[model samples]
Target: MTESSALPGLPRRLLADPEMISACASRDFARIFQLAKRRGGFHSSRIARTCELTPSRVGEVISGKRKITNMTVIERIADGLRIPGHLLGLASRDWERAEIPTQPQPNAAMRRLAELQNAHTTVPSRELDDILAIAAGSKVTPTVLRSLQVSIEDYWRRDDEHGGEALRPAVIGQLRYVTGILQDTADPNYRRSLHGIAAELARLTGWTYFDARQYSTARTYFTESLRLAREIDDRTFIADVLACLSLQATYQDRAKDAVTLARAAQDSARLDGGTPRLMAMLSIREAFGHASAHNREATHSAINEAVHHFEHVNPEDHDPTWVQYFDRTKLTVDTGTALGQLGDAAAAEPLIAEALQAEPTTNIRARAFHTFWLARTQLQCSKVELACATATEALDLATIVESPRVLTHLREFRQLLGSHRTIPAAVELVARISETAN
Candidate 1:
């Protein structure tokens, strides 16, 4: 908070400058270096040495031709220049703790923390002062944890209304940051919250990949999320990850695996004392698995159980944040989708139609997904013109959504309409679909 001095290198007056603070807040490293050079005595070569970067890199940064993103370099810049940790979203540095009795010396815990961090992180930093800061348990304030939660929740909201294709970079970056901190963090108490935050972020990252239809990448993140959740013994979150895996399995047509995963999710949720909404969510996945496997009896059994659970759901019941989305609209949509997969075109059409009609207009991603399902049911029922019209509506939303999952289902519906190609509406729909591809 005070003026920057020799080791924490920038001058006090320069640090207090409004432009300096704004640039640091936005991480405009080029602007930061330019200001440092002009206001502080930091020429490019000196800046390069201070921040553990090359002179050429420093020049590029000052010229606004490149931006610094690597955590290691950012940490060095913060430490070498003694920037306030809060300005850069880092832990308080050793220099900031000058008045306190110095436990800043590298002890066994700090060394071990550094080694583990180096082994796990691709962007490993040379500065271990923050490791000492972690050893002192100075990073990851409650506010920081809460901020992480808010960020993940915001990402979820955006993914719901819009799609995850545009958000994958930010979500994955956040996951990696939390993961790295978790790997080096020494305090058990801090580790617990870190792991919980990491789990949620990993799960969110997986969901983004799932929406992008990158099954392998999504599975990797899902598995990482499950591992973190288990480490924290967060049964509610554990069940959510398993449900995600189950849904991904169903998407990949691995029906048996989906069934197994859904059952695992149900078991985990039961351990946490399952809420009706939670049960209903997992049960629908089980139904999806059964339907995908062509097991009509099992599929209907699961669907019936889902409906029963939904009927028992109390809106006031305290369900997990993830389970809050499984309201009546979701239940109806899933049931219809499962029924359609089970080859009951007549039964599926009405439920999907009702769901499509009931869904909020602003929930473009969900609307796109549901509209395609409704279109598929219409096609199966030989309502060719109606199906084409429905598909076109979904196509419009899909363009806005950019979700591979929505487009994937739309492609399947198009293929199903192949038999009716001679129909004028079908021909027109094919041309429209072609336009989207272009």
Candidate 2:
């Protein structure tokens, strides 16, 4: 197996042996157990503990006297062994926590991200044959494509309500399945429709990774989605992908790149005669980029432009399905977030609070994000007590959701509270964050 294909924390020598990966991918626990015991120098007792199997069972499996068929047990073995999720026909694992070298590794996250750029995996010939047979027997229909679209939308709603970590695996599996179907479908029209849906799936997967704070993986998906969108001349999707990229760049502190990408998205949308609402979304991203760069004049200008476009959104305008959620509440929250980033807390607090109050209960992620921003604004205004209270509320909401992005923000808030640790509320908030992190 190539270094890129190796799962995190496994011995290099074991990965160098190609059979190891193949064995794991095929769920040949017997061979895996034997190889790991012999070649990998792992003790039978250690393997048993990791796999949650008795030592006798491990020996029996290795000796070909027993078979492991439980899916839950299989998952535990895969996770405990740090096996790559995709290799086992599962969703991608949390690459972020994968153990690597103890040395100071620079851009380690980016390296891990690069490994996932390609969706290709080498399955056993038997598995490949089964997939081909399934593909050949299945017929592609408009109804099927529509249903896939609806499923993607449902997953998006769930991500908003629950969190990325909760839904990432399921969505990744869906994307993989859709991509397989796309490869098998021979009809030209069906292929085109599948490509569009596949692009959306890729975009969704990328956003989920982004919320999980896996930026590099997110970038890879967005890039692939852009390529797929371009294949079908999907100008709207292209703009959306670019806008998503801009958001990722902004979070990474690549302010200039963020602005450039956001502007490119806006220009693409305009050239394609995109919906005003779509343009508004892109413009808001641009404003955010400017705010991050501390370019107050540019930030306000872009914000105004976004507002203008949003206000003129035609109720009958042909908008993309993805932008259906871009409404007044979203605009208010995004604008407030940008302002808060610019240190205009006095102006941002009320707007953010109002947006949070108006936000639907179903959008747990958005509420957590908005609450964090509101707390940040309060901190900026030196309202420490109120900030602590609001941050506690954000933390409470954050605990129920699985957003790494929200967790990161909460950590930043915790850091801010560090200076005011003498205050009782700040001290309590710090302890709460620490407990939650553990």
Candidate 2: list runs displaced more than 4 Å.
Answer: 1-138
lDDT digits (tens) for residues 1-438 of candidate 2: 423234334575575343464455446688778788787766788777665678998889887667676878877677656666765667766652555544543697855544554446443354432453364455888888887788778678768876766456556655776777788789999999989998998998899889888999999999999999999998888999999999999899999999999999988888789888998899999999999999999999999998999988998999999997899988998999999998899999999998888899878888988998999999999999999999999999998787888888888888888789999999999999988854
What is candidate 2's local distance difference test score? Answer: 0.81
Query: What are the per-residue Cα lDDT tens digits for candidate 1 across 282-386?
Result: 999999999999999999999999999999999788997778888898899999999999989899999988887777777889999888888888888888899
TM-score of each: 0.69, 0.71
TM-score of predicted structure 1:
0.69
Clashing pairs in 2: none
Q: Cα-based RMSD of the predictions, in order? A: 11.9, 14.1
